[model samples]
Target: MQKIFLVLLFFIASSAVFAFQSIESDPIAALLRTKLELENPTEKLEVSGRVLESDVLVHRFYADRDFEEVWSRNGILLELAYEMRFEIRQAKFDGLVPEDYHLALIDAYFQTFEANKAAKKPNEAGELVALELLLTDAFFKLAEDLELGKVDPAKLNGDWEIARKTSRTSYLDLLNEAIAKGEVRQNLESLYPKFTIYKKGREVLRVMDERAKADTLDWKAVKLDKAIKVGESHAAIPVLRERLNYWGYAKSQSVLDPKLYDSTMFLGVKEFQLRNGMEPDGVIGKNTAIGLNASPALLMEKAAVNLERLRWLPDTVQNLELILVNIANYQLDYVDKLDTLFSARVIVGKLYHESPIFTAQMSYIVFSPYWNIPPSIARKEIIPAVRRNPSYLSQKNMDVVTFSGKQVDPASINWSAKSFPYMIRQKPGGSNSLGLVKFMFPNNHNVYIHDTPSRSLFSREDRALSHGCIRLENPALFAQTLLKADPSWTAEKIDQAMHQNKEQIVSLPRKIPVVLLYLTFWADSKGQAHFRQDIYDRDAEVLAALKQ
Candidate 1:
C-alpha cells in the first residue's frame, strides 16, 4: 500500500508539472495573461463611463460581440486584446506601429467600427478588418515606445523626444524594405498614423496595380538591341512592347510590328491616359511615363489615408436621395437608394475659399436662381470691377440694393465708402452668374450647386475655381434627372423653365439629402480605392485631429 501511494503521488506531481509547462509554452495564452496584467490595474481596459450609457457604445459592443462570436468562437475581451497585440507586432515589422498614440488611436478604431455597425446596412467587413489592424498597430507602437525607453505613465500626454529624434531616412528605409517584400501596402491603415504622405502614396499604388494587371508585356526579359523604328519615333521595340503590356494593351504572343507603333502604341497611350482621368492624346509624354511607373506601395498608402478620411463622415448617411460632392475628386454624384443615378464634374471652392464639409437637404431647385453677391465679393470683386469698369454690374444684370429694399444705383454708390450696407443681386438672365439652374441645400456655409456660363472652366482637370459654390458640368441634365424622380415633372418642363430665364423655385416633392463630403480616398465597387488630390489640404488638419 505504501509503494502504490508513492507511485500515485509521483504521477500526480508529473501531470501537474506538465500542465504548468504547457500553459507557459502557449504564446497566445501567455499574451492574454500579460495583457490582463497590464490593463487590469491600470483601469484602461474598462469601458469609458461616458460611452457605456450612450446608444452608440451599446450598439458597438453588441456588434463587436457578434463579430467575435462569428469569427473567434465567442472570444473573451482578453482574447481580443491578445489578437490585437499580435496584429500590432505584425504591423511593427512593416514600420506601421502606432507608438505613443495608444488610447486615442484605439478609440478611433473602435469608434469607426461602431459607426460602421450603426450604418444599418451590410457591415463593411473590409473597414472592420482595417480597424482591427489599426488596433494591432497601436499595440506595437506602444511596445516600440517601451523599447526606446520613452514609456512614462505621467509623460504619456507630452511629446516623446525619442520619436522626434528618429531619422527620416531610417524610417523610410524600413518602410521601403517592407514594401518590396509585400509585407504591407500603402493602403493599409496601419501606416497612416505614422506618415502624412500615406494618402497620396495609396492613390499612386492603386493606379500602379491597375496598370500592372492590365499590362501583359514583360519588359525585364526583352533585349534592348532589338529596337524598332516607326514613323518619326525611333526606339527599342521590346521597351515599347513592355510599355504596351504594362498599360494592359499587350496580349500574350502579340508582337509589336515596327510600322504600327504610331497607330497602335500611340493610340494605346491615349487610352491609358483617358482611363487614368488625364488628358488623352496619342503621345508617350513625360507625365504619362511618370504615372505609369508609379509604385504600387505608394498608391496603397493613399488609399489608406483616404480610408481615414471616410471615418470623419457621419455614421449614418441620412436621406435616401442625396447629392454627394467629393471635393478632392472635384466631382458630384447623386445617389438615390444608395445607387448612383447621375454624376458630373464640378468646380468647387478654391483652397482659400474652401467649401466646408456638412450635410443638408435639397429643399428647392431654383430655375434662374438669383446670385446674391456675398459681402466678400461685394468688397473685393464688385468694388474692383466697378473701379475698373463701372458698367460691370449692369452688364451682368446685378443691382445694388440697400438693407431696406431700396435700389442703390451702382454709379451713385461711393466706391471708397467702407460703411456700405448694401446687398448685390444678379438678375435672372442668360448671362446671370448663377446661370440657368441652381440646386439649393441651405446650410450655415450658404453654399449650393449651380450652373455656370463659364463652361470653358469645366475642361480643366483642377476644377477648384468657384468662390464657394459648386459649379456642375451638365446642370441641365442633372436637374432633369433629379426632377424626373417625380412622375409629374419631365425633362421638357425643366428645359422650358430654364429657357424662359425666369426665377422659379421648384420645391422638391421629396427632400433629397446632400452630403458635401471631403473624402480624398474611397474604394469603388471593385474594392479598389480611387484616390484624389488633397485639394484643400484637409489631410493634415484631419491627421492633427486624429493625433489629438
Candidate 2:
C-alpha cells in the first residue's frame, strides 16, 4: 500500500510539471510575445504570476476559488495576447499605416482586454489565424497594387536585389535584361492580370502564347524603308522625310541626294515628329533618332511600368469635373465626364519639388486669388527681391504683415534676418503670380493648380518649371469646362464672372475625383504604347523593394 501511494505521488508530480511546461512554452504565447515586442518595444506588460496558470487550471481555480483572482488573471493575459496578435496582423496587412491609426489601435488593445475578461471562453485560434491571414492578404494586395496589371513574369523572377544594386543601369535596362534572359515572359499574365500591350498599331498583345509569338514579326525586321512613302501630298517634305527614314542624317540619304536633303521625305518626318510629341524640326536630331530606333518590346515594357503606377491610385472615378496632372507628360488634362473638355500644357514641379502623386477633391475655384507666398518661395524669391529693391513689396502689391495682422513696412524690417515672422500677400490682379484662377484642394503639401502669367513657358515640351503646384496654360478654358458640366451655367456666364475681376468662389454640385497620377507608359486609343521620360525616379526604388 505504501509503495503504491509513493508511485501515485510521483506520477502526479510529473503530470503537474508537464502541464506547467506546456503553459510556459506555449506556441501561442511565444507568438504573442514576439508581436508585442514588435509593436511596443518601449512598453512592457506587467503580467501577474497567476496569469501563467494553464487554461484548464485557471478554470478549475475559478470554480474552486469563487471565480476570482487566478481566473481573472488568466483571462486578462489571454486577452492581451490576442489583442497584440491582432494588432501585429493589422500592421502586416496595412504594410504602413498613418500615425493616427496606431493610436486607435492602442485603444483597441485595451478594449480587447476588458471584453475578454467578461467572456467565458476566448476566441484564441480564430483570432490568431485570422490575423495571420489578414497580413498575408495585405502583402498580396501591395504586390498587386505595385504591379498595375502589367507584371512581367521574367522581370518579376529576375534578381530584383541585384538589379536594384546596379545603379549603372536604369530601371528599364534592368527590366529588359530580366525579361530577355530570366524565362519569366511566360508567366507575365499570371503575375499581373490587369496589363495589356499593343502590337502593329492594330492588334492588342493579349496573350504571350507560342502562336502569338509566331504571328508577331520582330520589331527589328520591320524596316522603315517600306513603312514610309515619299509623296507630294505629305505635310512637309524635308521634315516628313527626315522622320520617316531611319538613316540618321549623320550621313545624307543616298536614295534622295548626296549634297541636297530630300524635302519631300523631310516633311513626312516633321509630320511624324509633331504627332509623336517631339520637336517638329525637319532635321533628324538625337532625340528623333532615339525615338525611331526604340523597339516595340521596349515600348511594351514602358506601358507595363506605367500601368504599375496607376495601381497606386484610388479606383473610384468621381463624377465631378477635375484636373488631372500627368507628371510624365508634363501636361494637365481637364477631364469633364465623357470628354477632355480642355487640354493645357502645364509646368509641373521640378526634381527637388516633385509633384506628389495623390488624389484630392476640388472644394472651390478661386478667381483672381491672392498669392500668399509659401515660406520657401519667400526665402528664395521675395527676400532676394527686397534686398535688391526695398520698394519691391509696393511695386508688386505685396504687404508684409505681422502675426497680429498689422502691416509692417518693408523698410522697417531687416531683409537679411531669418528670424522674422511675417506673411507676404500678393494683391489680386493680372500681374499676381496666381494669375486668374486657382483650384484649391487642401492637403498637407499646401500645393494647388493655378493659372500663371508666364504663358511662354508652356511652349517648351519638357515643362518641369514650377516649384510644386501645377501652372495651367489655359486656366480660363479649364474653368469653363468645369462650369459647363452643370447645364444651368454657360461658357459666356463663366467668361463674364472672370471679367468681373472680383474674387469668386464656384462650388461643384457633386465632388469630382482628381487623380494626379505618375505614369511613364500608356496606350493611346489606337493601342500604340506611348513611352514618356521618367520625371521622378520612382521605378528604381520600387523595383529595388520588389526584388528584396
Instruction: Give the alpha carbon lDDT tens digit for every residue of 1-548 in model 1.
Output: 99999999999999879755754664333333333334444233423221111222222332332322211221212344444434444332222323433445555655554575477443343434333434433433333332222222223332111112221123223333443453433223332323233334434444555665665544343333332333434444446546666546554345455524555566666666665555675555544554455444444444444544443333345335678887777889997765778998998988788876667778889997778888888887888888789888888788889878788877788888877778988888778887898999887778899998999998886788888799998898998888786876677787788866458999887888787766665545444434456677655543443334
The residue ranges of model 2 lying beyond 4 angstroms of the native Cα positions read 1-261, 283-286, 318-322, 336-338, 403-405, 485-493, 499-502, 540-548
**Candidate 1 local Cα displacement, residue 400, angstroms:** 0.8
TM-score of 2: 0.56
lDDT score, residue 176, model 2? 31
Shift in Å, residue 114, candidate 1: 35
RMSD (Å) of each candidate, 1 decimal? 15.4, 17.5
Worst 10 residues of 2 by lDDT: 158-167
